[model samples]
Target: MKRILVSFAVLTSLAGVALADTHGAIAYSPSTSAIGWSYAHANRGDAETVARRNCDSSANDCRIAIWFRNGCGAVAVGHRGGWGSGWGYDGREAQRQAIRSCRKQTGSCRVIRWQCSENE
Candidate 1:
């Protein structure tokens, strides 16, 4: 009975850790040509804050593009004055989608950044 209780306690702790929400954020400033991203943060606010700070170092008027919990995000830039971003459960899929989104606005597009939260 004691061994069973110890096993249950360990499993419960593991479950709690697994359930904790992990966050990711991206920041960008089109005018200043700056982009920053962070993943696997403990909270949304921390993720955004860190991303914005990284952007602020290189650009002005930086803003959060997106935030995701237990997911992935990506940014893409096009050849002809276009940019796009997307989020999804898979990092590669998010990058592909972001490129696709940028291609919608311009002819050719390439991925700028791809990041995934730990949970994803």
Candidate 2:
């Protein structure tokens, strides 16, 4: 009986963790080199607000680059001021997409930021 109860309690705790929302966002300056990113918030609104606020600390024209929930997000930049944002189930996939998007506008694209939600 004790063993069974312990297993049940662990499962219940895992379920509650899985139900929680993990929000993330990235913000960038339109005409500057400023960028800001955030992750693991409770909701999308808070994530975006924090990202934008951080970016705005360095520049006046900051904008949201991307927002994600329960996944990975990436930012890529290239020569000639090209920029891109992507979201995916994993970090590699997200970086690939960001580079792909940036390549459309300019060459020599590379990932500048990448993070996975839930610490994955």
Q: For each candidate, what is the lDDT?
A: 0.83, 0.86
Evaluate residue 116 in candidate 2 and report its C-alpha lDDT on the 0 to 100 scale.
68
What lDDT does candidate 2 reach at residue 96? 95
lDDT of 2: 0.86
- Candidate 2 lDDT by residue in tens digits, 1-120: 999999999999999988998988888885886888888899999988988888857598888888889988888999888989898989999999999998988888989888766566
Error of 1 at 87 (Å): 1.4
Best prediction by TM-score? 1
Task: Evaluate model 1: give its TM-score.
Answer: 0.85
Tell me model 1's lDDT, rounded to 2 decimals. Answer: 0.83
Per-candidate TM-score against the hidden true structure: 0.85, 0.83
Residue-by-residue lDDT tens digits, candidate 1, 16-90: 998988899888786765888888899999999988988867576788877778988888877776888888888
Clashing pairs in 1: none
